[model samples]
Target chain A: MSQMRLSFLLPLVAFGILALVGGMALYGTLSGSRDPTQLPSVFVDKPAPQTNLPRLVQTGSTTGNNVSVTMFQGKPVLVNFFASWCAPCRAEAPALEMLSKRVAILGIAYKDRSEDTTAFLQQYGNPFQAIGMDADGRTGIEWGVYGVPETYLLDSNGVVKLRHAGPLTRGVLETTIFPALEALGS
Target chain B: MMIATGLWRTHILIGLVLLNMAIGLVFISATTTPAYAITAEEMLANPVLEERARNLSKQLRCLVCQNQSIDDSDADLARDLRREVRSQIAAGTSDGAIIDQLRAKYGDYVLLNPPLDQATLFLWLSPLGFILLGGLIVMMARRQRGAAIATELDAAERARIEKMLASRDSENRPKT
Candidate 1:
């Protein structure tokens, strides 16, 4: 082959290969085995982030209770990010309520109003042991919450066991969340 | 009876038209969505800090939006992130330190351009690896193609053919 032909063919071949690989990755993301919603967290198996959210008005503990990392010590806790405005939170409200009967679920009202959250919980059933008001969403960011309705299963050591995105569906709870909690022990 | 049947058909036709219109309206409303861009009013007061925030925002992915950078996404989380970036910049935090802090909290996925780490080593190098492999394959193909075209006449083969031709000519000359 001529030198010119080789030079022209090189980049073309590289581009073709790159395109094929990129297309496969795109396809894998869209329709294949990879779940796009779950951004694999580094916080898993690491200590739960430091949080200092004010107590929700409903908690009314008089102790000035704030949700903090220390709360997860010596016990597995389910920390969930939720908002009244989130449609998926509404769907999972009952599921969370049912799950709460078995384990401690800590709720952080992500960037939501206290009255709205109170109404939402009253309308659906209050499932959280302690509800923290993440008014500015800074606490949510600290916990690496991407969106409302994300739940993290924490182990006794305050290390995150499993982080789940989206609403807590019955099937997901049964399969992943429950198993993780079960492994963490009561 | 004929008049009644015609009226009944008209009613059914109108129902169908309304049904189609409703579906068309829903589709329009669903698909005519516009993407949200972060507002200019969210800019930092210091031009230098604002420039840094802008650049950093482009580098940071909107976790909730999944694909778009924080600068491009309209999600509340993205807005919060832009505010966070600006605040960090204003706080005199270095750009690398801010990005590292975000990566620590959100994992490597938070960065629009992920750094080459153990987990992302393959992801970063795969493009170069593919290019090299592609070059090798093209080179091999070129060599094979050249050899295939040259098969009809090599120096030794051409010399052998010439000798054979010379012998045949001498043999056919009636031993002159």
Candidate 2:
């Protein structure tokens, strides 16, 4: 081939290679694996974290009620993390209320004011046995809460049996939580 | 001359078109689908649980992409990370533990919003530093140019140049 032809062809070939490599690199970077492989549940096969939260029945009460890990003992319990401001929490409330009748339900109000939580529960129809106000979100962090509306299913022994990250819908309650509860025998 | 100019104009037009097309393609690719896509199956076996898992996944950054969450990244490594998150959640791991494990494996870069740390100080400050450096260089160059223009010739050199110019002008004048 002539020098001029070769020069023209060289750039076209270079551009082709550049496009291929660049495209693949972008796709690789964008499509790479990000699965959480190493993060182990501190609560898995372990007892629930201890919490002391004020009962929201009274106003201006700084003193909190003691809730031991044993509260989740014997009967299977579903511990839900929620906040009044979270929209997904509102969406999941009805499904959670329905699940409450089937299994014991406990609520942890993450980083929410007592009054707001009480008002939310009242509005949404409180289905929890004991509602713990996690005003600081320290308890939520311990339980591995990324956001509101995370649910954890505990076995009769208070060991964490399953965890759901987002809002609990009827499908999940019936398919995953119910099956696990059934396997645990009630 | 007109023909040559016309040919040159044609070449320039072609070059401009090619450059514009390349730029357009780049913009299109950038604005398209997110870098990652977290499937419902990868997030949760139960259809009801998928939405919750997806929400959490969207908040957590992919270690490789740094800017994109695992839910938006489509990289192979991101897929693996998504699967890993699913497995952990399936195994009943908490959210804190999952984030901690990612931080441990990939360093703080895994977090979309990396914690304020010494290593990341440059990432935050480099743009400002570059702007300052460019301004300083421009100022220094302007100062140098101003100084060159303001520089005065010594008395002896000025007189020598004037004499040379006078001699040249006299030589160039016609004898009258």
Candidate 3:
């Protein structure tokens, strides 16, 4: 009787063991690196998306004029995508402002209210020549923005020279962007 | 006695159902979140540095996501972690040093393949131990079964004895 019970339970025990080990192995495999490196490149040597945006603040007490893509022509423009809520944007702000002296920069306020964005620039010290409000994030999608604080370096011909997906650190601005811009000759 | 047996069966059935539900919940909790996301900024930083960071990121699992590394996940926390790695690498921090820092903060759970240490020794050894233990138990059970069969007559043996008695009774009756 005991032998019969043992025989019946052995397969169940084996299955239980198999399940435990398989579960652990499956967990390891499933949780392992799904790194984004293998995905197709989104913005490598592509032309900057053309956009005409209204200025964030009217400097001359006049109606806010639309800043067109032509304004960035004949110069390297650093198009920065940022929001007031993004912490990395705050960290990268000073470095961005420093880079502004050497290159023309335009800000794209992604998914932020105009009032909040105005307050953010006031606190962080705005480095951009013309800030474009992308209130609904549609413009950000058009620009292939995966997240905030993405900076794109555009050449004189409006072709994207490089796309930096995070904050603009001093090292990146100096080592990568500056040299690349120098190669393009302003 | 019959009522007691019925109550016991019901209690066991309920217990089994609850146990299965708990197991399902643990499995779901352990396996849901993504690992990490290595962004373009980190990739384009520097070839040598980026390679090191990428390798380390793959080795370290995200604490919140538990099962995933910071490299494979698209979670906001994962993105923040990738940014932290980029800043650290750009600042010239060594890969080993960065891992140590993360391990100190998050415990061994952060490591996808944790080192064979006192804390994680059980995790590595448990599976093999269970397999060996199970094999031993099975062998012992088989031995017990064989011993029981050798010592005890089965129902067939009892039926054979009854047949012998019946045949003897017929012979005695005929002789009379």
Comparing chain B with the reference, what is the TM-score for each candidate? 0.63, 0.53, 0.56
Name the best candidate (by DockQ): 1
lDDT value, candidate 1, whole model = 0.85
Error of 1 at A158 (Å): 1.6
Q: Please give the TM-score that candidate 2 achieves against the real structure.
A: 0.47
- B1-176, model 3: which lDDT tens digit per residue? 99999999999999999999999999998998753356565474578887777777788776446678888777655665666666678888888887775554344556788799897899889999989988998798879978876987779999999999999988889553
Docking level of model 1: acceptable
Which numbered prediction scores highest in TM-score against the true structure? 1
lDDT of 1 by residue, A1-186 (tens): 465676788789879989999898888877634677878878888888877877886643323656775776888889999999999999999889888987888899998888888888888889998888888999888888888889988887888989998988887888788788779875
Candidate 3 residue lDDT tens string, A58-177: 342213677665788988888899999999999998998888888889898887877888888889989999888876665664565657888888888888788776777776677678
In terms of TM-score, which candidate is stronger, 1 or 2? 1
Candidate 2 vs candidate 3: the DockQ winner is 3
**Which consecutive 10 residues in model 2 chain A have the weakest lDDT in total?**
A32-41
Score every model by TM-score.
0.74, 0.47, 0.44
Model 1 residue runs over 4 Å out of place are A1-33, A59-65, B1-36, B152-176
Q: Tell me how far the alpha carbon of residue A175 in candidate 1 is from the true structure, in angstroms, after superposition.
A: 1.3
For model 3, which pairs clash?
Answer: A34-B72, B35-B68, B35-B69, B35-B73, B36-B70, B36-B71, B36-B72, B36-B73, B37-B71
